[model samples]
Target: MHIHKKLVSLITLSLVLLNTTACSQRIGALNDTLKLAFIGDKDVKLSTQQVNDIPYASIYAQIGDMSQVFIVLVFAEPKVSLTQVPTTLSTELKWLSADKGMIVTVNGRLVRTHNNPTGDLVAVESTEPDPIMLGLQLASTPKTWTRIIDWQPGYHFGYRATSYFNLVGQEKILINDIPTQALHYSETVLVDDLNIQYQNEFWLTPETGNVIKSRQKIAPNLPFIDISLLKPFAS
Candidate 1:
């Protein structure tokens, strides 16, 4: 009778051990899947500084009818960082001048422009309107008719004016076989008694609002800039 009792006890112990091992394996599998999901859904922010000899952001542009592509490196800082918010991304573009830049809100609203010709970055003051902000607004709000403040940077200041955006239409296009949507718009700026015209186009991913390609005319003298977001480097 003692031998039979010992046998029953051994079987119960073995079953408990087996069940514990299976539960541990299942928990480990659950943890592994959760880790993968977190990695895939995390947002990424990058700068112009190279990582393993690869730049974080690279933009390629080709002027009108030009076969050669011009490259622009995008950097990140308080100056030029695009911060991801719950709804949209807030962008700030600082010109070569440390004191001059434009800030756009998450909803693509041009909040302000600052200048510190005194060479003090900390002493920047919101002084005038910005034309670059107008271009950005056009890129962000393609479906809405928006009025933009137009200006061109000059030696000491920027030429300021008002402009209106008119949407041409939307067309289906393919970038690297990824079907995309594009919006074409024309802008008319009124300065003094003269009117300046610009044509803007933006190719974007409909789901993410990521701009794949863009063509913008900042000034008549400056080259009409065409920008294509470089794959593998664009975050």
Candidate 2:
């Protein structure tokens, strides 16, 4: 009877260990499944009411100038606000509040910005470089060449690297049925170890030095992203 009782206790312990291991494996598999689901979802869709309610402009980013994939650029909701106003501006016209400041979002996700010192757009988030600033810099600066540190976001990790920009010239282009004066420029990024050179183009409004259209390459593995300003936000 003593030996039988000892055998029964041993079997019970073995079953407990097996059940614990199985539960751990199941939890790990669940975690992996969640990660994959998050990674696979790339599109972020906002309702028309949401877009109209916010003080934001809409721009479309096309991949490679060929692929059907398109990404929308706008400010992320709730986290960003346009509450502050410029004191010296005309009292008759109400503008979007800039008190809370603004942020640039790509596909509803925050990317880096290239702040143009002369332009109206400003970077509130410090983690990413501002592309709008870069566009304004290219438009306003008299110098023919300049360099910038650009940040590219990724799935798990992002990278920042030096990129060079050159002012190509100025031209009048008809965008959205309007004849607009724009400053043309080109950007070149060199990936040293990869020996890959990526080229991008930009057209900024000459008056405000804001980016009107652009062909930007954020990563060597990704296609060139073309952005066109659909319309400016109406206050």
| Pairs with steric clashes in candidate 1 | none
Clash statistics: count for each candidate: 0, 14
Worst 10-residue stretch by lDDT in candidate 2? 90-99
Please provide, for model 1 over 49-162, each residue's C-alpha lDDT reduced to its tens digit, 9 standing for 90 to 100: 221122123334344454323122222334332322233323442211111222222111223323322111121122322323334334554332323233334332333445
Candidate 2 residue-pair clash tally: 14
- lDDT digits (tens) for residues 1-235 of candidate 2: 1434534533443343345343444433333322322222243233344333323344444445432221222223323223222221111111111111122443222233332121222122233233444344544443332222333333413233345667788888765446888888676766554567777787877666666777765455555556666455443
- lDDT of model number 1: 0.36
RMSD of each: 20.5, 18.5
Residue 52 error, candidate 1, Å: 14
